[model samples]
Target: MRIRTRLLLLSLAVLLPAIVAAALGIGFVYAEERGINQRNLQETSRAMALAVDRELGTREILLKALASAPSLARGDLATFHEHARVIAEEREASILLSDENGRVLLNSRLPVGTALPALLPTAVQERRDAGPDVTIVSNLYRLPRNPDVPPSFALQVPVPHTARPHLYLAMTTPASQLQALFEQQRLPSDWHATIVDRQGVVVARSSDPAKFVGTHVRPELQDSMAAGEGMHPGMTLAGVASTAFFSRVPRSNWSFLVSVPDAELRRTGLWASALLGGMSLLLLALATLAALAVARRTAQPMEDLRHDAQQLGDGAPVQARSSGLLEVDAVNEALVGASERLRRASADLEHRVAEAVASFEQSQRALLQAQKLEALGRLTGGIAHDFNNVLQTLTTGLHAARLGSDDKVRRLLATCERAVTRGSELARQLMVFGRVQEVRVETFDLAQRLREVQPLLTGALPTDITFTQDVTPGLWPVTADPLQLELALLNLVMNARDAMPHGGRLRLRAGNSVGQSPAQDLPPGDYVAISLQDEGEGMNEEVLARALDPFFTTKSVGRGSGLGLPQAYGFARQSGGALVLRSQVGEGTTVTLVLPRAQVAPQEPAPAAPSGGLRGAGCVLLVEDDPLVRDTVRSGLEVSGFEVQTANDADEALRMLAGGHCVDVVLTDVVMPGSMNGVDLARLLAREHPRLRVVIATGYSDRSIDMPGVRTLAKPYALHQAVAALNEAMAG
Candidate 1:
């Protein structure tokens, strides 16, 4: 072999690789360009679809508004036709009003007295016949005035009150409006766009719409799009091979298409590649001289920009300096802007974190307060149950003494009885705070009920304080226990009186709320708000936080029981309502009850009852769990001239009955420790001794009990009340 042949072989090795590399690079560039063009066509199709959907939605809203016009409801066809004409001309559309049988009564494009025509197609008429209230939207169809006129579609809505049944108000818009929407998207000039309804009918076309509108789309395109929105490569309606993308319009049974011709894209890509090949030799000559200078100029600035970006990521400030080159200067400027934004962002993030922490602390405090209130409520309920038993003994013993004592002794006994009555009221307040008190719900006008209690409220206030009322005249009726509402009102009024030590104004206001505000917790509906506003020393946030807790009072020790606010809160919640309190130090306080409204008819008022009480004449058997209560009640009944037998519990009472004791009535407590409580005992007696009378009495009774054909006596009852219950049971 020759030395020259060996050198030629090495040169061929380097040149062949360079030639192959250039060919591969050109192919990669063409593939990337094709992908970019495909994505751009898809995005353009989706944008056009969205724009057309918005246009149709605005038209639908307009049709619905015209359906609610007063002129149409009043049977004034002339006025309604004129009004529809003005609206149609302003929006560049046609309007029609039709009767139940689909006969056109008025068309905005023609004179009002023109002979009527059938305005709806067969498909639309079938839907209306099935359900007259249905909204009917039509596909594109030819205009009736002339075949040369543009195609149009109709939007129809039911007119609720018109001269004819199943009347409709329809608005017809030309296909030109949606074609204009497609054109407004500023898509590439060579791209073709069309809007089609669900039935494959072409409603609008960007190119030559006069020929394509109201025509069915080609069978090939319809079959491809039937599966859903997507892209495909196929021949277009005009017999040109193109890449087409389709998308569905939101909230409508319509779709849009964007098509780009493959021939046009291929021509552009070929021309670009040819120009690049021609410029390669010229660029090679210049590159040798520019590379050294370009590298020297850009190295420092590029490095500086990179280092500053890292600092910005670390939450530190950066200052960027520019290189003289155009591209490098652009990068430097972006870095500087980014660094400044980073500083501002860091400060904003710190501020947001601080606010979040403060909110979390406030929520934690509120949760703790609620838990404390719940625990206190449970404890208070237990104490109240035991306290009522003691009061029952005192009440019955005092009533017995008052009946048999001399003049002076009777006066002393009356004082004891009054004290016992006040104690019983206190126990009742505890039950209310625990949310265990039963209520008898009824529907009544809240405004009228407030007026009935106005006199009592005014008399309870101090002499130095003036009272004012601002009740809305025709407020909605509310469903609640009337007795509980009156007691809650009295409690609020008394609290207001105590707040103003010297003198202040107290106002009671009632109003209706539509529950539109987002800050309210009530469901979306109507409510009645009753507010008690007082001008006195208000509470601080810490005091307000625990204001609703049981036995939580700001007053001096012996001056308050702290049950007033809790009772009001409990009652409101138990009645499907809410209580809201707003107070500020050195300002005033306002407490409002948001009670739900009810739909109930008014009933005639009943006559008031007489004052005299009933008498007793039966042999009574008294059964109670507590010994003190049993003995005191039994002694009272014996003194009242009724034969009395006593038992400590239901089991003992059942034993006495099993022994064949003679008794006219059996009185038992509803809650006991044994397996058979008072309600169970009564059920047994009804079955075993069918003719024996029964009376259920309890200081704290469970509301779940079902006592049929028996009288009930609420305790802390006086001797006279017990005797009355006995007589009532005997008579029944």
Candidate 2:
């Protein structure tokens, strides 16, 4: 409130905050300089290490590729010169090959007859003894024929020589090559590098090392060599606190030590800190001026807004000259417009809300219609399944009737039978298209099963066509509906073969592919992929896009079914997978069947032979709610000579079993009777008569059955097919 006090407070606010910022800024600069120096040192060291590692890694790959040369694999030297020269050029290292006894067979630089050093390194010797490879560092300085460059180091990569029992691959890189590498790297000013031998002799030095080549560290520190205690900061040169670091050269016992001087680190850090401090003060002055200007400018607009708000609260009209500031003018204009709009919009919102409510009701009705359509699709699927069962029954009885008739009548009936069979197949395909058929799981090794189907795959192709199998090894086991998988593959392979009437390469490849993310056009997961590629007439992009839709095909009608891909698509969907098509107009088409990798594998095959006499003569209880189905099954059993009793559902079947009646088998349908289905009835009957065989029959083959011991049969069964199941049921 007082002028003196206000001045004091303002001074404190300005200078106090300024001083705090300066102190923090200066401290951070010092910390940052130290961090930068350390980072530079670490990064330089890592770069050097990585450089060495890169050379080593590249050398290893070069050595391996050289060892696998045509001359090496075939063991003939007539073509060896070009191969050896090519390897030398690629690796940038001289290559020398020798017999197990160290007699030089081939050298990149010298003639073929040149002799090598007699004493081979232990690494090379042992490698020659081992089966695959002999890789190690050997001091090549002792070898006379070794290059005249300084003390040399060589990597002896020995692999089996084709012509002889013991042969080797010696890849030599001169020590000077590495020293030159160390020499060329520009380290900090006053920073030097040294590489010492195992005996502490300085083998390589960046600076003039004539004075200290063979010198040893202090004996006290030398005693801790095994424990690595010679790495502390110590006096190496005047005024330089040299920090020593060490690492043993990989694949060797020799240790390498590098000394980084603290004076060099501190010299850069201190200078940087001073420079940073000067900059901090200058920035603080500028920032203080900017902050003051911003605060004054911000407060002016807020002050005007506050005055307007007060007048508006008191119900007074505001009149002021428009500021030249565009933002300020815009804010004032917005406030005026908002006030007027609020009054008018309040009355208008009710009418708009009523319109919105009507729109919402219309949208709700459309959604209901869509939901009903979806529900109708589901209902049609259920009815189609029951109708399919009736069709199967009609076909089965016709076949049985034809079997008992004369040969000429049988032939005529066969023509009608073909029509019926085709219709049944069409119905089955349609049901799949409509999403009625679900998954029916049978345990089989997918890779082996695919291999077995190779014959069928090629059979569809022309005689000149060549089909190749590109199955990846270590293919994981898969659990899925085997029948559906076969059908899907059948469709793809048949399509591929049909495309190439003149015969081209038809490849069926299976492997693990990481599926793309949904955002990337394919859904993400590990997929077991079976790709069928044909070097044939590929589809255009327009046709390919709609390839999986029902009745979308390029083939001439009557020659092919348009449902091949659609059926495959349905099968893939039912089996928790997807069917994808990729094609180029002139290039080949590839059909990829991607199934999710199964976590639970298929069951192993039974070790023992399955028991014979699956048939048994016993009083059997057949539970069928459908009278026609019951009568047909009873007639088939009467011909097969097994006494049969009847029931309508699970409860009736259970009642008869519990009534102390003699019954050996409880045959029932799964989706039937009371609260208890056939699965539940079977479970109860299993415990009731542990010896009685329980058989479950279903019209819905794709329906899942989780009960352990029930033998499942899909209907409209023939007398023989039903007999086989009954025999297996009656056996137990």
Candidate 3:
């Protein structure tokens, strides 16, 4: 076929399908737009409903606060009435006090000595009496004495009194107060919003609220209101057709409805489709004309280009010639330079290929190193878990044995307990290195914490190396896991000590920092920078670059695991800070930890320790997968004046509970070999036996238990500490 004929046919084929696609897309766009409008309606309804509920909640809070006044509690009605009147005026609501017989004792809206009617609704009284002490919201009603006023509702809170058990404190809020909630939404002028109580009586409206207040919704919306929340085609109370969306208010039976006129919705879709279709048709016509012009202009130029390509492929030099068209003329000029460019490209191909291979090999080596480090972290995490369990067993056994031992034997047991504590610390370090440790952040004075750890830091260094400390007088408090911070500091100090084999001075300094550190890519913020500087042979550029990389070290294999600096770096970053290192080959090395400053002040000192005595007495169910830990914990609890039941795992614990093995508290391990872990077991117990207390014990730092009202005891806890936790849980 001729090129012009082909181009004309191609344009027809493409344009025909495009027109059909545009037609189809109009339907999709219409549906999408309609869905977006529906979602907007629903969201607006929800927002308005939330606002209404928030207003009601505020009134209920005020009434409850007023009910607790000392004047009311002491039967001083004159003083209480004065206070209630002030509060009612401030809140723009009326406060009423009623006796058990539904007779008003005091009404903030009326004079103190005026005779009041028994105005409490029967439903409000019955609901409050049937359920626990709670706030009850009455349906819309008019005051019996003042029927001319707007419709209102009451928020009733029961007051605990010695003589009058059913004394009620009620706040009367005009339904019009809810109209403000609708106005806050700023809905389109064409849109309408309504709020209806449980019985479908209109309490408030965004449009003509005064006319519609206290009126029942139209029959067309009765079924939608029954469904609680949904979208449906309906008519507004004024008889205007609309697409309405309704959402039920939280903590109440009321519903909020938002509606847009059907005419407006349909008009919007029609206008968008009409405009889109018009634009598409115009573009299609222009494209057809452009295609025809191009086909006529390029047909001869394409022939010339084909001949030039054949000459170049046959290794013959071709003479350049212009073809009038700019693109064809450019192609002719390119043929003149093609031979030289190809020659140069071929000459440099080998060098480029070698460089690409070198880059790929380096990437492959780095990837392999990353994979090895990842596998090492997983192995380390598992080892840490089992090691902590062993330490817990040892610690528990030492505590259990020291109870009745003589002075000498008790002293020996104390030494063993210290060793167990050290082992636990080592396990925690492994977990930290594996990035599996849970950090409990708290605000603490860094200088005070450093002073507390001075003994440990000084003990870790050799006597030949002198240690010096210089802390800023008013250092900023920082937020971090205090234990982790201590561990990081100890690791840095140890690294400094190792660097100075020969006697050298090591200085520790802490001060506040601000702004950015470009070298570390530190963000601009307030920080507490703690630096450890040493006078020793420092790291070279290459060593410094990989200093924080996991398992990269210069020390002998048995001497170091190479996780010290890396762990410190991870801790700093996790605490929203950065670690910075500045070093040279000969001039000493300085490692600085730039920790974000705490926004809150440091907490007060903890209370004094409880007396050293076992103070628990309850039946305890002990669940543990490890036999040694289970036995040690059981013996300790039994010695603390408790009857103990044993279960190997969650499944066994469930069976024991099902078989009517009564226990006051269930102390279980979090991670176990079972269908359910300790957290799951605790939740199940909570649902099935809510009155029972639960205490979870786990050595794995990464497990986060979010069960409120349940106690958690870290593994390797002393007998007294476990007893204290159990006691607290039971009391709670």
Candidate 4:
């Protein structure tokens, strides 16, 4: 086949399916538009129904108030009639007093001596009989003597009378009052709204109130309403076709209907379909013409290119010419230059191949380094858990020994306690670096915290490298783990000191800032930016790019673990902020930690700890994986006046509990070697023995426990702290 003919056929193949899809999309849009319209109409109908019910409810309240009139209870019909008339005038309604048999004893719309006809509807009487205090709403009804008045409904409440308990007070509200509600809706002119009673008789019509009031709705609509509330197709009273939505008013059998003419609903869909079909046909015609034109213009050029390709393959020289198309012309020019370029390309290929091999080797080394770093992080976390256990054992043993020592021996024990505390801090930092510990966030003044840690920050730097602090006045408070923030600052100061081996001025500056650094990607909010600037040997771009990467360091191997900057970065990010670094080779490096400002005032400092050790009387179940820590803790608890039982792990604890070995409180280590951990055991006890208190003691845990009846005591705590934790848990 000719090229033009083939191209035209291809165009038809592609265009035909697109045209079909366009038609399907148009059909779906039409259906969806119809659904949206129906839903809107349903919502409007429901809102109007609620309005009707509220209007009726208001009138019912008025009737109940009238029924409790002192004059009515005293049988002073004249005085009661006067009061009812005044209320009726104020509410634009008519009040009537009726007997249980539906006889009107007094009518607010008539004189007191005038004889009144039976005005109570049977629905109201039946509803009243169902419950004496129940408010009843009757269907559209007419007063026998007032036939000229508009259609109205009755709201009645049974009178609470000592002697005449059967009496009822009623309020007659005209259907025209509902017309005001419809007007408030401000529906489109073509739409119609109506309120109908249980019998499907129109109580109020939005379009023609006088003509349709008290008239029965169409049989089709009546059937739709009988089926329940929803959208249906029907004709308006004027014989115009419409899509109708109906919803029943709450607390009554009456329903409200909203209708839009079918012409209005289908107009948009019909026009869209016609317009889309016309556009699709025009597009197909234009595409076919373009395809034929393109094929004609490129056919000779394609032939020439094929001949040149054959020549090049045979190592023969080939001529080039313009082919009108840019792409085709480029291919022709390439053919003319192919012979000379192929010789040069062969030499360049070897060089490119060597570079590719070098790049691949570099990438392999990087991948290996990354894997090693990841393994190290996991190993660090595991080692930290055991390290905490050892620290706890030493802490508990020292406290137990110091309980009866003299002042000289107690002073030595206090020094040992300080060493244990330092060890615990080291273990916690390892857990934080490994990303296994949760941040304990609290609100605190950043400026105050910086001042408190200034001594430590200054002491870490060399005397030659002067340290200075600049804090903005009235610094906004920030929320974060205060202890972690202090550690991060210390790490930054150390890094600054390392950067300036020759000793240069170092400054720590803090101030309030908005999210001004686009590179940091901090969220747009108020933040406290604390930056440490050093006049040291700054890093180049390559080194700075990987500065926050774990285990990526430039210092000598033994001098740095490459975790300081990364840990600070992790802390900033985990606290809902960002770490930003600015550095150059010669000038200096400035590292900034942007922390989110606290939304509330800083909490007041906690009260001082009690002076003496806490003593409690109870059988305590101790669960620990470390035998030395368990024995030490049990001895300490025994000295505090408690019977202690020891278990190796969570499984043994559960077994002991299952065997009915009663204990008032369970003190378990969070990180334990068993099928379950301390958190799991605490949750099980919470479910099975809700009254039992649980105290979870741990140096560090990857998981957090926030359960009732559970208290957490940090590792390396003194004996007094453990006893206090137990006492608090038991009391709680």
Each model's Cα RMSD: 31.9, 29.6, 32.0, 26.2
For model 2, the stretches where C-alpha displacement exceeds 4 angstroms are 1-36, 85-93, 99-103, 120-134, 139-149, 160-166, 179-185, 194-232, 235-241, 245-258, 272-732
Clashes of each: 0, 1, 0, 0
TM-scores for every predicted model: 0.35, 0.29, 0.37, 0.38
What TM-score number comes out for model 1? 0.35
Of the candidates shown, which would achieve the greatest TM-score relative to the real structure?
Answer: 4
Answer with 2 or 3, whichever has the higher TM-score. Answer: 3
Error of 1 at 431 (Å): 99
Off by over 4 Å in 3: 1-15, 120-132, 161-164, 266-271, 284-732
Put down candidate 3 lDDT per residue, 649-725, tens digits, no spaces: 99999999999987899999876766888999999999999999999997876777778779989877888888899
TM-score of candidate 4 to 2 decimals: 0.38
Residue-level error in angstroms, candidate 4, position 700: 99
1-732 per-residue lDDT for model 4 (tens digits): 866677878888878889889889778777777777778778889888998888778777777787888998888999999999999998788888877667878989899989877754675457655676677778888766768887788777888855544787878778888889878889999999989898899998889888999899998889889865997787899889998899998766798999899988887776777677778778888988898888877587777888889987766777778878898789988888996676577679889999996885565555645543644543454556656766776677676665644643454355445445546655554554345666688998888878866745665666578888999998999989977887788678878877888998999999988645533476577888899999988999899989998767787634565767987998898888889899998999999998888999998766433222567788999999866577667777786788999999989998898999979999998877668888889898899999999999877755667887689998878888998898888889
lDDT of 1 by residue, 18-71 (tens): 556665766676667777777777787888888877787788788889888898
Give residue 349's error in model 4 in angstroms.
79
Model 3: per-residue Cα lDDT at residue 99: 66
lDDT of each: 0.75, 0.63, 0.79, 0.79
